[model samples]
Target: MKKFLLSILMGCSLLEAAAQTAFTVNHGPYLQEVTQDGATIVFTTSRKAFSWVELKQHDAPEAEAVKHFNSKDGLKEAWNTFSLVRVEHLKPGTSYDYRIISKEMRSFQPYKVVYGDSIATKWHTFSTIDPQKRGGSFFITSDMHFDAAKLEKLLHAADYRTCDAFFYAGDMTSYIDKFEIPFTSFIDTSVKLFASSVPFEVVRGNHETRGNLARTYSSYFPKKNGKIYGSCLLGDVMVVMLDSGEDKAENHWVYAGLNDYDAYRTEQAEWLKELMNTKEYKKAKYRIVISHFPMVMSQQWKDEKEWVGWEDAIRKFLPVLNKGNVDLLVSGHTHRYFFHEQNVDGNNFPVLEQGESSAVRLELHGGKVQFQVIGVDGKILMEKTISKK
Candidate 1:
């Protein structure tokens, strides 16, 4: 009898091990859209599994654990690989640790179901934005164009030792090709870096709107209100993120009658105008606009272009933005770095861009915002300081 019991126990142990190994984290645990009161965690699984995030205050007792499930927030009960869990009502500017929990689904059908053993990821901690904090820092890079090695190298050299959040101005991938290798490569690299910790803010580039998979961009990285442009508060500064549609005319032959950016940009410009009048914009100590393309660029082509790409953008948005007294505009699209001082773009703010091989690090504190353009070799290419006006 004892020998038979031992054999049964060993069989069960082997089965559990196999089940655990079958379901693995395919990507992420990456942080997204984190605010003072809430945050969203995104991850993918190797197999279709029911997943959730078990989180708690970093300093809370173990017994006070909170289970954040996607289903409770209107997500379906179907077996899906990707999981997005939004944890809400969290205390502002607080530290918390969380782990990804998943159960492998062998079969899912009406009235009959089969599930494997459950597994959990190792705990990772992150802090929400602190509204009252007077000092903080962030990192920004752009125009990666699907270069993972360059992405990894620039981030590694920057170190992110004191970064509160990370931003990709645009063009992380050349095109959204069915969420295939190119898209996954860009996301995987980002997940490896700040996914476990800081917030990952991404802006859409012109290239991202191309290919058959272009429309799927938001299904991966969703924006508030389902619009590509929105604003968020990072401490005392309000970061305005915009989507500059294709860098060419809507009626251009290359668009194949698929692009309608001129009207979209006009809609966004109207939204910006309304947003500028809000108390949130007026109360913030700093206002910064982040977009993929700049309103001003000196490089002009002699192709006798009838519909220049930026012409509509400048006509529709610059007038409203200039009236709002924007303190700074950070952008990337040309793949070449440059800083246009105040009034250079018919706007009162300075515009800065981080080129293909460099990253921008900004330190916000003591009434001044200090930024440095650091190359992949860990050398500072340019340094600029802006103070609160």
Candidate 2:
């Protein structure tokens, strides 16, 4: 760690201090909105390191490091940057001091991040956002698309630090084909600010569905979901993160293979089946489902070229959710915010549509839950309650 820190110091030293940018240590953490369960941490890649040595958090410049993801897969993408770090099983409702530490730098021949010196990065501390309202409240929002100004405005307006955790429904960027400059930078710079005081959670939006999206997703926010579908228990709420396949014409309309997308969804569905049956889930005060696309009624997709056949699979998945008595299904794909109260084949669930810069909160009561949508200005756009008990 000593050598790593010094290497980064030397690299930054090589550059004129006059031109060096002063890094706001807790400034921006996630390029995308940050997500946390108070115990598990998740975020996007925050730095551009070519070598593993520079990959180490102790190796990057303070101006360039908070927490970052380094991945070889990123090599083909924007500037070949990848690697998202996940520190898991952290103490709940506790504050911890963390110094960014990459796995290790393995190479430096062609793209020597630092000439000969190692990168010893700086250290900073952050308190884990308390899941329970004791520390503070939490917010839910998504679909920013690297709109730095809007994100910044949202954060500023929300005063993110006041919340214990934030949940992103999905769509952090406009596209994931290649990393865009400020988009990644937005996650790099802006997200940290949001997470530093309050942690956040994420669901993969359609925008993040391009090119090795899973690899990218796992790199930064590595956590075990036990299966493809994952769940996180935060305070009194249980968040189910679903890998809801794709909703494109080729995948949705045209005959789509029931097998191709099965790998991701099958695991998730099985996990959901068992999870919904668990005693903890059954008794939980609040339960919410998050996915990139919405699951409407029993839409049959019994065909090829049309992925609607896969719709059958989703129907199979819903029975479990219905039995579980889920309170809300949060999704973002249409890009427009709309809410609907529907009984999915007799199963009642509220669909909360995510819009860019929109925030939603779930307030729990003894026997029911209320949903309130907050605009970027912290004003409530809509409010509704469910007496599902």
Candidate 3:
């Protein structure tokens, strides 16, 4: 009787271990940093220890117009559990069918990290939001790095469901250590709340400077530039997104001999000069630069890590926009939203500085811009209105 009882207990233990292993990987693949190119649905996905991963662009949620793709180095090696893949040149305002496949793990790796492991476990559909021409209102919120307690408190504070579109300026995940799991959860919540209905352009923040953070960032945002520094047009604005690549003093690649700040500036300087001359930019009524690092100093210094030599580089970058008649420079590292105005070449260019906060409320009409910084409990922290002379 004792031997028989012991066998059952051992069996239960084995069963529990298997269940735990599967549970870690079984969560639905989270999607965020959604952007649309024509009609294609471009977003990010992360899963664990699945055998194979492939992306198919389909007419229906289940049908296959598979525009399949593989990872950078294939999937045999384990980088981060997150992966990014984009379906090319889709139609405008169309719905897309996508599947993330996770096959059982083989004793050996499969397809280099291809479809072998870490993919969406099921099919999900995302609709592309209309472009600037079909102009509409979208919401901008920065620094919602998740804490269940904090998120729950803010969720209970207000109704955030009214906006037609949503934008995340950066720092989507607060955890730079484990790197994968936390970021995945943040995206899942946004999607669960139906925030994925419209296209969102995500910027790369300094926190994305961790080991597999870039890989994780790339995994979920494959559509971003092979390196995420470039310009895109959204409605009436010319949006220039720059990748600072973690440039605070101690933690950036600059400290590790990975990047030369001056060379990077020189390389991007050329692009900045040329892109400013592009037809879309020259013609657009609004030109905005979305960076993870704010263009100015924080309200009060907190620590050494909070300061970087970015101001010098930004000073170099701003002149091009000043010459090009750019309208606004917006960022979210300070966790506070502020609006300032400066004269560039005798023309007024508004500087909107922001840190990681909940949401920013703004309205542009009749060539006037007014922004309201609304915090928890409906308290209005700051508001500014700009009138064109």
Top lDDT: which candidate number?
Answer: 1
* Residue 234 lDDT, candidate 1, scale 0-100: 79
* lDDT preference between candidates 1 and 3, better one: 1
Listed per model in order, the count of residue pairs whose N, CA or C atoms clash below 3 Å is: 1, 52, 27
Candidate 1 local Cα displacement, residue 114, angstroms: 1.0
Q: Report, for every candidate in turn, its global Cα lDDT versus the true structure.
A: 0.81, 0.54, 0.55
Candidate 2: count of backbone clashes, pairs at least 3 residues apart or interchain: 52
Please give, for residues 1-389, the per-residue lDDT of candidate 3 as tens digits. 99999999999999997766552333334443344543223333233443233444545434454544444565442333433344556665566666555443334344443334333445666654345453234455556665434443333333456554455666666545554444453555555565334445567666655543445565454454455567766556566876654555544544575445556656776788998877877776656666776555443542454455465456656666568665556677777667666652232477665545455655555566666666666667777766643
Q: What is the lDDT of candidate 2?
A: 0.54
> In candidate 2, which residue ranges exceed 4 Å CA deviation?
1-91, 101-123, 126-136, 179-186, 212-215, 225-228, 249-259, 297-313, 342-345, 365-368, 377-379
Which residue pairs show backbone clashes in model 1? Answer: 30-195
Please, what are the lDDT tens digits per residue for candidate 1 over residues 1-389?
A: 99999999999999998877677987888887888888889888888888889889996776787887876467544498878888889999899999898998889998887997678888889998889876567788988887888888888777775677788888888887665544464678877776778777888888888888888777676554676678888777888988888877777898999988888898899899999999988888878888888876664632446446667776787888888778778889878788988886586778887788899888777778788998999899999998656
Stretches of model 1 off by over 4 angstroms after superposition: 1-21, 72-76, 180-183, 299-307
**TM-scores for every predicted model:** 0.90, 0.67, 0.71
